[model samples]
Target: MSQYDHPTNRDPSNKTFEPIEHYGVVGNLETCALVSRRGSVDWFPIPHLESSSAFSRLLDGGGGCFAIQPVDPFESTHRYRERTNVLETTFQTEGGTLRLTDFMAPMTDGESEISERTLFRKLDCLEGNVDLRIVFEPRFDFARTEPTLSATTEGVHATGDETPLCCWTTFAAQPFEIDTAASHATATATLTAGQQEWVGVSYGEAVAPTTETCEQALVETVDYWREWSHSCGNQAECVFGGPWHDLAVRSGLVLKLLTHDETGAIAAAPTTSLPEEIGGVRNWDYRFNWIRDAAFTVQALSNLGHTAEAREYLSWFLDLCRTTTPADLQPLYSLHGESGLAEQTLGHLSGYRDSQPVRIGNEAADQRQLDIYGELLLAVFEATRSGITLAETDWQAICEIVDYVTEIWQEPDSGIWEVRSEPLNFVFSKLMCWVALDRAVDLAEQQGFSAPLDRWRRHREEIRTEILDEGLDPTGSYFVRSFEEDDVLDAATLMIPFVGFLPFDDPRVRATIEAVDDRLTSETGLVYRYDGPDGLPGGEGTFLLCSFWLVDALALTGRVEAAETRLEELIGYVNPVGLLAEEVAESTGQQLGNFPQAFSHIGLINSALHVSRAKGMAVPGTELIGIELGTGATVEAVRDHNHSDT
Candidate 1:
């Protein structure tokens, strides 16, 4: 209920809220939010991930919240309604117990009943004897202002002074009285074993709802989530098919909810500024889409065999690609392509545990992270394999990116680590440069696209040789983040085998794995990025995504059992919803950073797919272990498949 305590204690007020990680994600391809173990929705942004928040309590719990926690200290359990948008949270108290089912289904695909609004339908005890309590507290504009709460024919309403935001609530049964002195309302009711109760919260431009009309809306909403869950279809053919395919597919559906379906733009994660290092200045907005994450995300969908989603994202990305040049492309951008995010903090209600300086926007939008060019190219190339035809202008724009990458491939930039400290020419950035040129040649040869084939091929080989000769250690046993550092382990290195930069059998890859174990791992199995100040001073929970990356690499190397053991350990970190955050703190068994991060989910899906495919297992049934990412395929196979524009 409070912000988390800062790890370093440099800023005692910057508390990082250790959110209990149990959330069932359901979305309608517009946006997704995280609902917790105690049945509190700590993280969710209305309208869009990048837009102003509808619920900001996850970042600053004092901001405001509309939670349905058990008032009797009962046993609470939660889950997603099998393949649907419906969320079920059950509370078992001594006086029998109750179930709270939540969902927000979109009205008839293109319906015009409302311009833009979310109807939160909380259904309880349709046929059970239990008492249920409800709290509807409205805090507008990051909990900066207090709204006036009042009763309505529908149920309840709250309006803020400065923001034109109104929240309307409705209940199915005759509920309890209002608690105006608390600036909120509470209702407790006992239902017969076969009776049902409902509560509805509508935000944004709201109109009065008749009791009959409101009840109908709840029914329609349940139908909406069920329909969305069905869209996942037979796993492997979508984007990331096979093994944990259901998990991957479901996560994709959640991503769809966090995305603007019409715009093809996807948010990094639903929550913002949730802190990387507790109480450290590491919190940044993640609602915006990132160019670097695009390829991985598309790759996940492509791997699932979701051709449409893959192509849709690229189409959306290309729209944002009208940059002055490739180098001008920012690492991340808002869903609508707005640039220059300024950072702001809220001083009210205290932070989650008092992690002070609750940030609203990310200021790292314009940093020169050169690796994005390669990532972007990789994404476009994958779209082609999925059967998407690129327009001439699109192809021209892609080539421009390649051209720009050529000019700055040698410069020292912000590296893949995105270190806030001074810039360095990270090995990951240069490696991606190689990927860009390598894929370009393949694309031109297969698609008959106009390209300087010989020049590109030479450059590709040259980059590879330079990496081997200069970027690696003299012994050729390991690779470093930069030419200046020791053999440091990076979660980014899980990418070595993936990008075809090295074979799973390569000694260098093996050494990197061992080096990672020696440096970044905790005795209890958590992993860290590396041992250094990344532009800020403090500590953080181990990076969960990176740990999963290690799991995939172990599988690739044929260490199946070892990989599985690690996979299970990592899975243990997941809250009840099968969702993972950005990092993990071994000492506390608490999830850190943002909730329901896309990268962590991508790792979970990709590794599951690789291990599942390698071991011949499926995702929803058995957790895959010891599967390698880039094994089995020969160098020739990679080259041929990558070059075959078909």
Candidate 2:
């Protein structure tokens, strides 16, 4: 092996240049941290996703960060702990091989409620000797407040806000130094072969953790994840069983991490202000829950046999219904069900890649998106089908929503895309409105509920006729984006078959899919959401979710081989640890938009399941041996088991 000085800090010139896909996600369900492969905790929310961020280096260089990485020039690789959300990154250096494990311990009771606010990390020297450095910086409230740092016998304490955060390590704290001017702390350490160290950071009111306690928490965290994975049951019983089983499970975990355990609210992503188009003005906060996104997420989880999540989301939905009329329902809400998420720009910092106007709350919450009714109805219908008994109150709300759809189906409103333009008769929106009535009529018939079936049937038929008449092009070969613009092709039209508006084999549906493939797909097979404007100026990357949609459409149309090939290619777009972002830049193939996007993962799960069933593949089953971490069993042993099976 060779010897060299490790890279202690990011180069001054390239501080904020890490690609969005270059990071891995680790969360304790209450909150999450985005750790770059280079070992920086760049983006993390304190206490919860909706709370102010304590580490915002991802958005701006000087914002804040907590990092521990090799100071030498080295190559590294990373993966998640087997069947768990824990992350492991290994650096192969000239002097030695160093492995770092990162995780937020899960609740031991194994319930969804998250009470842990600590991010745990362990470092081991696998060979020779290596040097490393650690940096801890906290910028509470988006860097508007700086914490005063002081060292304690337990570790370093950052006191500024009501609740202080403490960073503790197993080793003596001799190497640490408080950089008062920069509002951060730094440390350096050297490890020989076979040596290891444990470190952690915790916020909010809690006892300062000792080395032994952190170690025990790590063990419990592994057990928590393994039990949850085991609870998923045999792979043979899943709708899609193949080599993608592990990826699918990981995607499910990603979706779960973004959900608020208590309220069942699912955020679109666990981040805010990450740009859809780098250096463009399209950045918006996604930390809140959107009714449409959450509905789709619940349905996906239900399909994956995690009906608990589905039931929870429905309960949350019922709460929203109690406080809302169908006509006045907002498109999105805070995790606790607040509707006023006022949008604002934080002018203090530069965005990722110098993108300006870092945004906070989402203004789209107030948009008149009519497609959410369809999404909600579909979620309820799915939950009811999955043996989740809907409350009578839920049924009543469903009926009210159907009645509202009947009155508003003819009116133009923001479509599924949430375009800011004047409301036009978007074909996708009309199709989903039809879906609402169609599914509502079925629910009433199946449950023998007292819904006005005749009225619903009449309106459903009318909406279908209108779509066939106006939503379709003059040649009737394909559906257009909107009635006002009949020539434009839209990727959303490809959902015609998936939502049962038309059969996959229908010539019109097939032509629409082909049209999108021809016009919206890049050479790399990534699909654009659309080519038209959304009343916003900059261009966005190819949407990852839409690409997955194409995979499902391809499979449903009997193009099994093509769909399988496409699925494999899309899976390649996942980050080093199997997480996906909202979009990928067509020009560079770099991920864009928010990191670990729930919708992108949902698309992966749905499309993979669809294609796997179509191709007649069975999920390969692996025997899971729960490793007791404190019993001298190495973390690597568990990772090896999962890697081999996968």
Candidate 3:
């Protein structure tokens, strides 16, 4: 018998959650699954990204999973099929070598259509004979409801409260047994050299797979992903060329996967309740679309020459704006643009790595994040600059949003980090408010759209004056996190230069960057969001998004070489399959929080563009949007000025 055939490894009771970085993701642009290196589908939400998980082993041991692994002990390595989201895992066992290909097929004949909910797993014995085992266990509704299992001619059928799941295989006669008490199914098979087999599962009315159908699906899915990636500007034309080109493309692909194709909404991340600090209460759901995150995502994709996604997202946001007044606009919403995301905890399930109170929704949805208006308007401004025309109603929505910002920009509210403490006058929030008015005035003048341009211009200058005066430290050398916390340092202020709030050569911008570098940076150069109390207990890992923002800050200030080095160090934190989590542990270098985070990837894309531009490389689509690279001063001149100041 093989080593894996032993009771300890084969038994479901012995299963444990894998590290957040141990898994690679595959999706159909609607929902995604996290497949571990051990060949287990541990976290999969059926129907939609925000729907109840069909496989929740990532959260609790009792949460179910579907795994296919060699019966023999083996070492495995995996990668995505070139330019596509299809994942291939190769296992090297003493008995033989085997390859496992996993993907969620788009199931569409054309690019414009939506995809069916189906996952395919194909196996090939590349060398000698090999023995394999298949375990299918699904805990529907976060394990609250036990699914009724029945054997089928093709494989097994599981009926639960949400949706029925059908698992089928191509093995002869489909030999598998259902354990009704445990609510799981199991099967085993052995194949000789060059032999192949397939396993597939579908949700709802999708047809069960045969070997031929699975093969066809693989080809179609690969083609779809490759075509989509190519549309994001060919690698030859990629502004970020050299060692960072492939990484940039992969980040684009991840952002695309998190986006809902039908609704044009982008998820913050594919998973929920992955803790920022292990065993901490900082975990929150990220599957919903935050207007702040989606706006950033749209701008990043548009800069990469993928303007269609930008157009779609703008259309969706405008539709949402039409239904509500500016005061009622939520910080986040469902993929279909609905709000009311009441936060709740799944008490029955243990969180990832015993982090308690696994959460399902986000309370930050109800918080007043004034920064989203700036982000949304900036995205709209960039979209129009990229040649996307807005309809009259869309322009009307933009006007109302800008007008609303004029009234509330001075109010204290939740900062960009969504602190749970009482609202304070956050510098980042105020900065984005400035961005909203600046872009609004420019858009109105350029497009000849009627608006209160003079009022917007006045507010824009007033915001700049306020930030320069009260938003600074007592020494007046650096920007503070908020006016309330004058001594605290925040990394979000790194974007002041990127947003054109100040010239790169401005002494305050330089001082703010240096202050964050000295106070908030980890030993590994990763950046923490802030150094003040956030009303939450326990410390979290350095924020990846903030780290990338620092990268941009460095590059845009005459520190191109320093930015390149920091960019390389940050890229080293990506998982083996080129995915980034929300945060990275400073002590152990382990990734923490949600896997395949959209915000992190968005930051990487924008930073790459900034660095490339700083290096005097030609970046497409940036000229149209007027991305400020620097103050046109030579690096030596800027360095000399800083030296002389010192």
Give the winner by TM-score: 3
Off by over 4 Å in 2: 1-14, 107-115, 173-175, 230-239, 616-646
Error of 2 at 243 (Å): 4.1
Candidate 3 to truth, TM: 0.94
**Candidate 2, residues 218-300: lDDT per residue as tens digits?**
77888877766524466777655766777888888888888887688898998888888888988878888888888877666
Tens digit of per-residue lDDT, candidate 1, span 250-347: 56555545556756777777776666656666666677788776667667655544566677788777776655566567787777777777777765
| Alpha-carbon local distance difference test for all models | 0.64, 0.78, 0.83
lDDT of 3 by residue, 1-646 (tens): 1124345654544566677887899998889999987788888998999999999999998898988888877778779998889998887788998889999976343653223588889999999988888999988998887888888888888896888898888899657888888888999899789999988788885357667677878888888888887343555566676567778788988999999988899999999999999999999899999998998887777666678888889888988888789999999998878797899989999888899889998999999999999888777877786788888888898889989999999999988999998999999999989888877877788898989888888898888888888899999999999988778998888877666676567789899999999999998999999999989899899999999988887776677789899998999998878899999999999999998899898888877777776775343212313552221112332232221122
- CA RMSD for every model? 5.8, 8.4, 4.2
List, in order, the clash count of every candidate structure. Answer: 48, 8, 0
Roughly what TM-score does model 2 have, to 2 decimal places?
A: 0.91
What order do you get sorting by TM-score, best first? 3, 2, 1
Q: TM per model? A: 0.87, 0.91, 0.94
TM-score of 1: 0.87
Off by more than 4 A, model 3: 1-13, 107-115, 231-237, 616-646
Task: List candidate 1 stretches off by more than 4 Å.
Answer: 1-18, 23-26, 107-109, 112-116, 126-128, 161-182, 208-246, 616-646
